[model samples]
Target: MKKLLHFLFHSEVPDINERYRKVTSAFVVIFIIGYSIGFLQLLHLGPYLGPGLGDNVSFQPLITSLQALHSQNPSLWYALIALLCVTVSFRLLVMLAGYFLFEREEGSAYPIKWIIVFFLCNLFSTLTIPLLLFALATLFWVSGLDFNLGWQWIDHNVRLANQLVVNHVPTLINAPAPIAVLMIAIISGFFHYWFHRLGHTQRILWLLFHRPHHMTPALMQSTTMAVFTALPLFFFIILPYNLIFGACTKLFSSEPLYTEVIIFNCLILIPEIFGHHTALYQIASRNQLIRLASFISGGGVYHYMHHSSEPEHCGRSGAVNLVNIGGGPLFIWDIVFGTYCPLSAKTPRAGLSGQPELHMNPIRLTLAGLAQICNELYRNPSWREKWRIVIGSSSYTPTLSTDFAIKSNKIRQEQATPNPATIKNFTFSAPADAIASVAAKPVTGPQS
Candidate 1:
């Protein structure tokens, strides 16, 4: 038990400052990308919805809700605004906290790199999601099938989901909505824990999407770049339960689901943000929840092990690698596969830089992305190194390990030496034959 506890908490002192910059950068990047996609989607509705109501008719309720904000109660409006702001602000604070305690930079206390990372990843994923959804929606629309968007659909799904949960786990229905949500949350958290563990331990999977994510070992606010995966997993599994719980409350005279859902969702964001950011926040001191969530697999600890930099001691073992150790709330899938890496077991070897190596080659990039997706889905990454000459770089360094420092120093020393034959005088403007003539007649006395 003691050893188990130590393994869970042990972390190499992280460079929080560097991580802060990363987190901030990623946030900004994703934000821009999100808005940009939104803008493009808005453009598509230019002919149909107009500027004021771009695509509004397609999703009236969501649009109406947005439009209603102007006349809504000040408290309600503020709450919604605060909610969105919290998404960004809370995450930034997590990074900032780490920066203050553990990070160091040359001139600034806060690392600007985090800000850049935020924008970069935000742009990439945000744009990607909307475009993806739009493409899918368009495909369906063009197929002559009209999709309905309304509260009724939400209500129906919620009710159905509630029934499913109750049927499978009766204890959930008996508990208070928050308690029920908590139970679901616990299960969903563990699912994340295992998914992440597998993402690391299974090399084939790591090479694809997960590899690009690990591009920066140091924190970049873009750490939240994986939110798409994180949020959807919970939404599909736990959220419907909450929605159903809320619906049942209305039918059975129970508390509103909004309060609990909002609180739980908002709270869940903290770990989501902090877990991915550099380990700067001491929230770990009171991290019972994190420990519980991570212990199961996809939780913070499970993901953290995936983030470790030590060679041999790093990577996942398909068995017991925390992130994707199992396919359950805890780790049932991993147990089935015999790849479960328990927290108490020796730390699994960190997988190869499962991250896709970004290169300028068009074919390589496409292949890399495809490779990553396959790895993530099937857990069979066939990683191959492709060497290319870097024009201006003095040398290429393979993997950012401690040996890189030594290798860099050696490169500098090698560059310092000049060939004896190529001394400055050897390059005189006088003809090449002049050097031969001068050498032949070099015995002349210095005295005039």
Candidate 2:
């Protein structure tokens, strides 16, 4: 048990615990800040009523006015504030914080700085979200007239997904929380994995959207990091189902059930952060039972395989279908289709062939920061860039050529081994204590 705990919390690498601690602290701080912001908006105070000891039925105009003053839905104000904070101030704060907390030197974590970069990129990305919502609204207005302009198509799909999650799946499974979570994990995981892979397999998708995600080989602590590039891939394909399914979930489920869904979403996002980030962490399966659970639950090292660079690691071309390639949290469809990769005790890149450079140097990084600001300022919107939806159908076959596969493999490999030397040379920041600590106490490196 002690050994197990050591691997999970410590590993051979020094400061792993410290890094996790910092991240947790950051999350706590952010959550508290968010709550404070929410509180200041005074949206929590709803219609209040007081009962008199004898005449409880008596209503007073003054009391009503006071209650109205105390209680108002600040949804619009909250949204506006979130827009300003997340889009504008968040990045600036992160940059300043990163520089303050992290070092700019070699082998140090510029996590703080990276956090800023992620937020700014994400803030810029949010601009498209409002546009997406408006486009959908306009399409809905047009579809009301029976004029088909591709808006109703998503609405139709959302309805279908709504039926699947709210009605069909519920009836099929008796258990609510566990079953709902598992089912969602499976279905949504499949969609996430496939859609994510699809974004890589198809070059057009890669060029149009995904490259931005890969553009930064690592991740930072910013809501923008979560929302920005993720929005493109998420909404571009899954928004219809997501929006409709969410509505159906709320409509069909009671408060308790809704709470379960929220909990499950949080659980999923934690692993998601781990999977998407450049940080390589693994949940080593202890025994066969645990391994079996990992394949179904997908909390194991399976996702790291998708990020693998070796020819053997991801050589199956036709297997590019997301549903078939199961990544941790249960999507039984992958197993039924024989695509599930069992949990391994080893780290993801262990024994895998190929290396890729994913990180950028200070100069390029600075340029990226500048370009992000510029694009936010003056980038033009086009019809294709606007209101784009990705649906898999008989009409559109997402093409995946062999050369494309090779190139993707190479990119993943390169991303694994960013030129830290180059990055450090151009970097003018202090070195991270985590890296310094690790360097001071050198342990045997992972058997890559």
Model 1: residues >4 Å from true position, as ranges?
1-92, 99-118, 147-172, 189-211, 227-256, 264-273, 279-303, 311-367, 371-448
In the range 1-448, model 1's lDDT, one tens digit per residue, is 9986444333122234554665654655555445322332221121101111111223343344445654856676678556646654655565555444434422244435433443344455445544544564566567775433221333344455555444443332556765655554444434444445444433333433344454443453433344322211222333443433333333322322333444444444444544444444234413555545443323343444444333223222211122223323343443343333323123222212322212322223213434323333343222322221111111222232111111123211111111222222122222233222222322222210
Candidate 2 has its poorest 10 consecutive residues by lDDT at 46-55
Clashes of each: 69, 20
Error of 2 at 417 (Å): 18
For model 1, give the RMSD to the true fold: 23.6
**Which TM-score value belongs to model 2?**
0.43
The CA lDDT of each predicted structure is 0.36, 0.36
